[model samples]
Target: MAEEDEGPQKAVADPETYRESLDAWMKMQMPAAEDLRVHAVDMPRATGFSNETVFFSATWSQAGEQTTHRYVARIEPPDGGLFPIQTRECEISCELQHRIMSAIKDSGVAPIPELLPFEPDTGVLGRPFFVMEFIEGLVPADVPRYTQAGFLVDDATPADRERMVRDAVETMGALAGLDWRTMGLDWLDVKAKGQPSLQDQIELYRDYVDRELSGREHPILSASLDWLDANAPSAPVGISWGDSRLGNMIWKNYRCASVCDWEAVSLCPPEADIGWFVMFDRMSYDDFDVPRLEGFPTREEQVAIWEAKSGRTVGHTIDYWEIFGAMRFDAIMIKLGDRMARAGIVPAEPGISIDNGTTDGLGRLLERQGVSL
Candidate 1:
């Protein structure tokens, strides 16, 4: 469910104190700086659903000169997140996240942001977090659904949109093209549990959906999940950036400047990433009931571009993964919806029809594949 962001949301943490803490922490990290101070810290208007992000500017004097830097910190949720605490054996640690990006820094798949550090200790920020060099660029709005209205839709040229899409697809291809084994990232591999990787993921989501709904039946979501199990793809696991899409990319010059949001990064067939990329892009238009913006590649065009860039034929398996992607996002929305309901933000609809758009989208995708839902 790619729901629109109503407006600029507030930060979960205070800016002034957080900046002071960050200033002290960075000073310790830089032993050489005699006088290290954070000039300012600002929580950008845009906030992510899962993590609390903070931006800071600091100036430190080493010897007789002063140097300045801007950094971004991604703090993990303390209680829990939208998704379940990933199974430890198959989980992504903050250290692993840092390693993943570091390994691919030279791959040309995407502009890799420089990572500052991965702090596992929570005492500093009341939760575990990591930092990266701040990248100045425009990101398509997730809350506003870029297609509905935004800097991207309102001001970006049609040619700019096309280049953005192309760059994103190519970046995804570059990520999938990397040698995971050589990169020493085999720790991310999950045993299929006597089932295929695709099916394993579906069951995980099914269980989460059950938890989210408290065993309440989500007919359309359940139907889509069942269809995915019945029509699972046979492709082997590869490096699938779990949250692949244009919105996840920070853009400059209409091309991907840096790829963000790797919390759901996983090992799945390349089709999984392709499916996510296409489904999420479509959700912006589908959920908003708007026409696809001009120059943005169609689903077919996206797949073809990825195939050309990654050198892997999408073949017929993409539909199965697309359903899986929808189901995955559906389960997330269910949990997120439940969270909102508890907070009195929205009514808790028993039928969970609020996810109808996502389910409807999934149903149509299944039908297009000739699978009865």
Candidate 2:
């Protein structure tokens, strides 16, 4: 199998120094343990662009017995990462992510890793980070495109692929149906006094693109934003897994083991998440020009699964949200391309971000809707 560019690396420069600091921090968090040692501290290569994810194991002796615990720490990037680290309307991204995951775990609406208390003291690792019990499962790889290769294509039977799609969509639907207020997650609602949540989300992305562009123009993104504002759908607000996609899920036995990546969680209509799910499906297969592996549900079939589980009529709202999803994704790609250039992972001129498949797909979607950029 051929490997694709994994994008920029976010690992800390010195693992030994970080390990020592993390070991000390663990000692403070686990006071009762004797001879506690942190080892195998490593920054995983297969991680998203938003946070620096570190995996490590700690062993401690207590009551004359030794216990080992494996953990994954999500550390805020000092550079504010791919998105703005702080915004007036929301908490710090890492802190917000932790709180959202905790709330979701409490609600029991979906599966999440067991979370530890969030540590805000930058002294621990030079940045705020949260720890969670490490989950072991196969995650669909994004590098080579899962639709083209990997477990889903090579190992999974057709029935297994069907089950995977069903479970994944059902999980997304359940999340879309969550009562944010009841779950104490209303803090995720960042809309102004009378602004619709969907509009607020669009504005937020608009602002993000503006800041990322820093005076450059993304005409496609700008036009898409206008279209979203003009054709925004009216729907009930619900929890949105901002970056919903199969690649973000951990699977075991063709069932979703856990939904990872909460950095993009927010309060939006169910269509926000549903749209992202389907849009990503298109990106993974259609945009990549890879034939979707047999057994996976069709785009419409997946939406039907979501409708059944969420009890919400998708109707034509999907068309609107799909455009919105593509816009958001393209904006992120812009930021990603900028980050990669600044880090020298890729050249800055003629950047890969602006004219990539994401933007192309966005253009096609917009053109299909008779919206011109």
lDDT of 1 by residue, 1-373 (tens): 3435343223337788788788888988888987888867887643234677788888888889988889888776433456543356334345455656776675666788988777866668766678899989998887778898887788989898889898899888877787666666665655524223655567777777777677576777888877878777577666777889878889888978898877676666777888898888777877678998888888889898888988888877777767778878777777667666666666766534345567678778768877665
What lDDT would each prediction earn against the true structure? 0.74, 0.82
Relative to the true structure, candidate 2 reaches a TM of 0.91
Clashing pairs in 1: 4-143, 5-143, 5-144
RMSD of each: 6.1, 6.1
- TM-score of each model, paired residue for residue: 0.88, 0.91
Candidate that would win on TM-score: 2
Residue pairs with clashing backbones, model 2: none
Per lDDT, the best of the predicted structures is: 2
- Model 1: residues >4 Å from true position, as ranges? 1-12, 44-49, 84-86, 89-96, 106-108, 192-196, 350-356, 369-373
Worst 10-residue lDDT window for candidate 1 reads 3-12
Model 2: per-residue Cα lDDT over 60-159, one tens digit each: 9999999999999888765555643223534556787888888888889889998878887675776778888888899999989898889988899999
